[model samples]
Target: MKIAFYGSSLLSSYWNGAATYYRGILGELARHGHEITFYEPDAFDRQQHRDIDPPDWCRSVVYPATEEAMRSVLAEAGAADIVVKANGVGVFDRELLEGVIAQARPGALKIFWDVDAAATLDEMRADPAHPVRAALPDLDMVLTYGGGPPVVDAYRAFGAKLCEPVYNALDPATHHPVAPDAAFTADLAFLGNRLPDREARVEEFFLRPAASLPERRFLIGGNGWDSKPMPGNVRHLGHVYTHQHNAFNCTPLAVLNVARDSMANVGFSPATRVFEAAGAAACLITDAWEGIEQFLTPDTEVLVARDGQDVADHLAALTPERARAIGQAALARVKAQHTYALRGVQVDALLRAQMKGANA
Candidate 1:
């Protein structure tokens, strides 16, 4: 099928998780014989940070991100078998959304792929300025990345024709265990950008643990952490690229996961790192969150940490052999169920359903 993916930067991860998401899904879709044209709005230096170019796999169409570009793209978008518009394109996205709805062919599928369902819903509920408030019923379908039970029901309640959660999964080719890089090797590591809402949880789940275990080396990766002071043992690497993630995962004795406020509140939302770390055979020590058990069984596949003491205890109790065993078990689970290929199959099913409904 000829698919047109309209989204934010395809290359930059700057404050957005959608970039990694697009690379994984669209890259795998290309491998599956689906033709893809990815549109990127030239808002940031996406071309500079691009890890993968528009090889034989995809046609990359970058627009000027203005109203004129929106008009031009909507004309071309009408021809696609499927067209996807996700959140945060840095353009006049409301007008762009209107344009797409106005210009799409009757048979061409239109989907809103949300990387931030929780935040989007919250914004809509809180204020009147939100663009998606009355536009819920306009899109053909709503697709999300990480919100679990609550998000699906809420989107349906908000008048969506269909709402599906395409949770983050590991790309098998990219995220397997590798030998440790000396710099990333650590007793424990946490990687995520700093946000005001997630700060307290980071303190409760990460910083406090570092303070408790002063002798152990802890690494932190992600941008915007420079202002935060840390214990002497903690190493802050500003941002680790997608290519560096496997070593970052495999080299840690146990990787720590702390969710942002929306994810924690919505429940069952696992970040891409969770799957990546699992695929790299890294034993995970994650902060206690609802719906976590659905992904991994506690005390066997993963260690659950509700507080700093729990995190410290997890580290103290680990033996290298036991850690490797847990990592392997987690990795096995991801390979069996959560690979990108599995996700693509689900997406293809949804698209077929939309096409079927369109015909009927």
Candidate 2:
């Protein structure tokens, strides 16, 4: 199959959290003998901060963020067996959604791949005229990176023909255990781009815990967090690149996963970081959310925290040996059930089935 994927930057993880997810899924799809042409707009200084070059797995087209450029790309969609308009392209999203459907040849599958399904569903619910809401009925299917049953049901209610959650999984080749870097050594660390929806949760699960554990070192790595107030024990390393993530996870005694407000509320949406941390054998402490047991067994594979107090309590009781054991268990679980290889096979089967049904 030839897939034309329109998404945020695959070459940059600068402000695009979905970059790893795209690489994991699409790269594996390519390995499955599918041809992939990824279309990402050159916007938001992403081109200036690319983490990886275009890989052998896919043809990456970085087009100018202009109407003409968008039109040119949409014109090429007719050649693809599957045309995907992933959410959060950060430029001309509405036009791309409508245009992809318009440009796809008859019998070709058109999918709206939502990396942030919780937030997208909220938007659609609040405004019936949302572009995605309007596009749902026309789209052949809706594929989400994380949201489970709730998201699938919601998309179906909005007239989607099919909706499935393709949860985030580890790319072991890209994110595996590494020698600890002294610079990232900390009792606990949290890495995510600071955003409005997640800032408060970060304050609760990360900062507050840091404040409570004054003797323990805490690290924060991501963009736009330099100005945020933190406890004396917390070190802010703004914008750690993807290459350093393995060490960042390995060096820390434990890593924290704080979901955005919407994801936490929606339940079952695991951030990409969860799998990344697990793959690197980092003991993970995640904010309480639904469906965690579906991915990792709590208390053994992962540690769940209900609030800042729970995080502090977990940290206080954690021993180096205990952390290592938990980390190893999580790593084993993900390697067996959550690697991108497994996810790629699932996605390959789904796309092929859809194509067969369309022909029939």
Candidate with best TM-score:
2
Overlapping backbone residue pairs in candidate 1 total 0
TM-scores of the models, in the order given? 0.94, 0.99
- The alpha-carbon lDDT assigned to residue 24 of candidate 1 equals 79
Superposed Cα deviation of residue 39, candidate 2 (Å): 0.4
Tens digits of per-residue lDDT for model 2 on 73-103?
9999999999999999999999999999999
Q: Positional deviation of 146 in candidate 1, in angstroms?
A: 2.2
lDDT of 1 by residue, 298-351 (tens): 877888987889999989989999899999999988899888888888887778
RMSD of each: 1.8, 0.7
